[model samples]
Target chain A: MSWEIIKQSLPMFQQGFLLTLYLSLIGIIGSIIVGIICSLVEYFKIPVLNKILKVYIEISRNTPLLIQLFFLYYAFPAMGIKMSAQLCGIIGLIFLGGSYMSAGFSGGFNGVNKKQVESGKAIGLSRWQLARYVIFPQGFALSIPALAANIIFLIKETSIFTVIAIPELTNTALDLIGLYYNSNEYLFVLVVAYAIILIPLSIILTLLERRVRYGTFGN
Target chain B: MAHSGINVLFEGTNLTRLLLGMWTTFKIAAVAIIIGLIIGIILGILRTFHNPILRFVLRIYLEFFRIVPTVVLLFLFYYILPRQMNLHMPGTQVAMLVFSLWVAAEMSDIVRGALISVPIHQKESGLAIGLNKFQLYRYVLVPQAVQLELPATINLITRVIKTTSLLMLISVMDVVNIGQQIVEANNQKYPTGVFWIYGLIFLLYFLIDYPLSWWAGRLEKKRLEQTNGE
Candidate 1:
């Protein structure tokens, strides 16, 4: 393997890294919002929506992310709507991420003290106001560890977007590696590239989770 | 391409192809679950130890496995492990290795979580009843931990099943591979074979997964009812 050639191509690969970051950032933020909403819908026990949301979460959660990507990428366009690959990938990620978020957020919701809700009601708060002011913060704090784990999972899963031909880190690495008869060099480089992205993210997640756990305990 | 051509896809052997796909999928899933459960439990306990070096080593193992995507992990074991280490195994064996490590890491986390979830009071109560520490764990702790662990364990099983699809990317002749091959073979006769072929695979996964998942939800619900009943 020519170190010089790889050294030169590093810029292109760096661009791919940016794309992966962009995709994951958008996916995480969008899905967290989606997840919180889904959790609330479940938490408040929406009458007709309760069953619909439950089934939706189940389907999204049970199947593989890859199949979901395929559905979004291949199935949707055939129905006469067009979307960019990145959009499809993001949407797919959000769908999976959102479902996961519901579980964590709801778990956190359940962790909130029952007294807190009762007190809110005692104070003559409307349901929405009680949920917004009293319930969400406590629920959010309690579910932080589980929520962080899901976000970390979302980061790891972003690599699957490579299948839909997004030039993210995994795809970029695989592209370069595929050219080489020496598969070992490529695989190592790919693994290192992954470690570079994931390890720091893992540390950040751990620290965030610990901090959240501390706050929850203090409360 | 747009709306799924699922109807055309499952026209004839839809049921058979789905069953075949699931048979293969579940075979991999079944093996992975059993092996993953064993490995996860061992490592989880290893992680709970007071030994600094051992804890550090297990932490690194857990983080490494957790960080690497299963697809990349599979590729490492399938392509590079043999070249660098001369440990040549069949694709299935290589996949088992990659997934076992993955399973081990995640399961260990679950095990750790379950163990911790058994209230500290419960263990103390056992002690108050004159039970020793190890005896307290064996008798008072493990069962409750198992109950909490069941749902998460089911989630892991579902994950392993879904992940097995990535095996096809590396030419593993899995359910996806089989579907692709048949689709390609019939491509000349029907231009839309890819749709039906893959769609069939999708249904197969749903068929296999939905029921087990329903059971898991039921377990969680039963837990709730029991707690409510109490």
Candidate 2:
């Protein structure tokens, strides 16, 4: 409960905070890309790719992210393919978040009315144009709330990267605990740091979800 | 060059140890899910009551659990409580508490949604028949909510089971911990077997979870069809 020790560990915490942000940014971008690609593969019903994605999503969704991280960080090295823990942790997070996001995005895609797609076809738009103009926007709108919720889950899951010795927020707090022998103080700051980053995103998500629900994905 | 993966399991008590760990995983997850769902059903009912202060407090409780990472909560209970508050519990028990609280948060949300979705006219009709609050809920609301909540609650069971993997991080002897132990013991002789060993861990989880997920989907579809027909 000493402020002096907590102050001394502030620099370490700052560094960890930065790494957490970096990891989450990569996770968000990678998951969105992976999610969109998976959805597209499903939407078009690409035979081989869709089958692969089905298996990927099934396994990814069913397993815990921690075990998935172990597979990449610990298992791959045994197979003669070594990766840095940071690299493996981020990749694991992407795969974990991406599977869930793909499911959410596909829900949004399916929410697009069938008649709207038929009308788009009647308008003689190319399939690519049809998706780009008609489907993607509507689907993205419908998915905003689900996407936000998934992002929040992803943010919380990022804390698990510490188990792999990545110096994310949680690990940094643990490190500080070791150095300062004050688990209470360090974990307090750690919780605050995570909340500061997450709460605003959640608020924005709720607002956006409400707006979208009211049928005003504004022009 | 690595040793044979099959030999690692048959090499004395390794397989027995792993199966025991798997049993522990199931035991802890089952206890947590049941307790969480029971607590959640109560809170969910409370959440729908027309009391602003009660609803507000419930929201805070749910949001706090949802916002915190599971690992942090586990640490707070497993490490901090013992050291600071002199509240010591076994690692497995702590894991159960952490997960049960999380599951309760999730279950409460599901329950609230199902409860709210019950038609308003049903409640009105119950009141017209001179039913008390207890009788109304027992006869009308709880039954309807169960139909809506069953599939989502099944899905939550799969989630709780998968989350038990996190217990390994806290040094609980769950299946993943056993996998790690096997890898550590055999690292020198059978380095390549890490792939198969972890793959086996993945398959074990998939066996437990995939069927539940499939069943949940089927239940959800049936519920939807029933509602549509009605």
Candidate 3:
């Protein structure tokens, strides 16, 4: 409500915002790489690694990121595996996000038609060639919507990094409220800041989804 | 380092306290989901109406909840509402309130999708059979939609249950908070206890959530089979 407080707090919020953006970017990229590897293992029906990845995916998907972060940040120190809060936050996000992304990617992999694979084989495409020319592109196209949803979910989840003392936007707003007691102004800024970040990202993803849906890659 | 980390869980009433905390988590999630389901059904039915203003308003509500993180909303209700509106509700109640609104927003969309997915011929057949509006929905539309909505509803229930972990942020003394308290109390005596305490919390959540997810998957598979058979 007050412009004066808003101006005063802008720098702190900017710093928090950048941290959040940085962490989310790292989390998204890390999870995508993880997802691709896991999906590939599943698609190829790799023996021991497939079973291990399955259990990892199940445990990761079933647990909340908050508790996972608690385990990493607080519990690990006791086990002589200390990590910085930022490190914990980054690891926790990828640990959680990777499972969800792998599920999405595998769903896409399953959706790639058997006929397509057969035709690729019929055309003398080797195993790697079959996957490269036949499966990955179509599967990636099919997975676009799921990937977008997981991205949004991961971004929103970064709010909880505040619990481990990361100075993300949520943490910054709480700090300002604790200090100034201007809960209205700070909360307003928090919501608007989130909206500003999330709304455009969602719109862009939707556009991306549309392009994938109608584009020639899948068809 | 001298003692095992597992000792902390069995020592004193730590285990009992953690179980009680899990109950509180369930209590909050149960109340929120019930309230959300009732309101969401109403809103969803309204959304199926041809009113432009109502549709627009509902869309805004859905998008707002979807875009904003649950933690931010928790802060708004728990921190801001008391000072701004002179409301002095407890943190648990505020958590329930925020989660209820969120679940309602999500459920309404699910309901709307299910309702519209019912073929137009069914509604027309009900009308031709002299069924009034209420009777039409009760006899013809809702039953069909309910079947379609069941798997999605189960998935939502699992989501709400898992999300209750956030209640600890508001200092509601849920399972996670209680675990933290146990770890703090036993830090000297059981230096490795933090791992066991949080690992138990993680397993507890997995036990509660995995069954529901499995059931939802089963329902989804059954529905798929039925549709493919038809």
Candidate number with greatest lDDT: 3
Q: What is the interface RMSD of each candidate, in Å?
A: 2.2, 1.1, 0.8
lDDT of model 2 at position B56: 98
Rate residue B7 of model 1 by lDDT: 47
lDDT of 1 at A195: 82
Docking class of 2: medium
- Superposed model 3: Cα runs more than 4 Å off: A112-131, A208-219, B225-230
Ranking by lDDT: 3, 2, 1
- What DockQ score does model 3 reach against the true complex? 0.78
List model 3 lDDT by residue over A166-196, tens digit each.
9999999999999989888888889989998
Candidate 2, position A123, lDDT: 94
State which candidate has the highest DockQ.
3
lDDT, candidate 3, B6-55, per-residue tens? 99999999999999999999999999999999899889988999999999
Ranking by TM-score: 2, 3, 1
Retained native contacts per candidate, as fractions? 0.44, 0.70, 0.84
lDDT of 3 at B36: 98
Tens-digit lDDT track for model 2 on B118-194? 99999999999999999999999999999899998998899889888889867899888898889889878776767
Instruction: Please state the Cα-based DockQ of model 1 relative to the true two-chain complex.
Output: 0.54
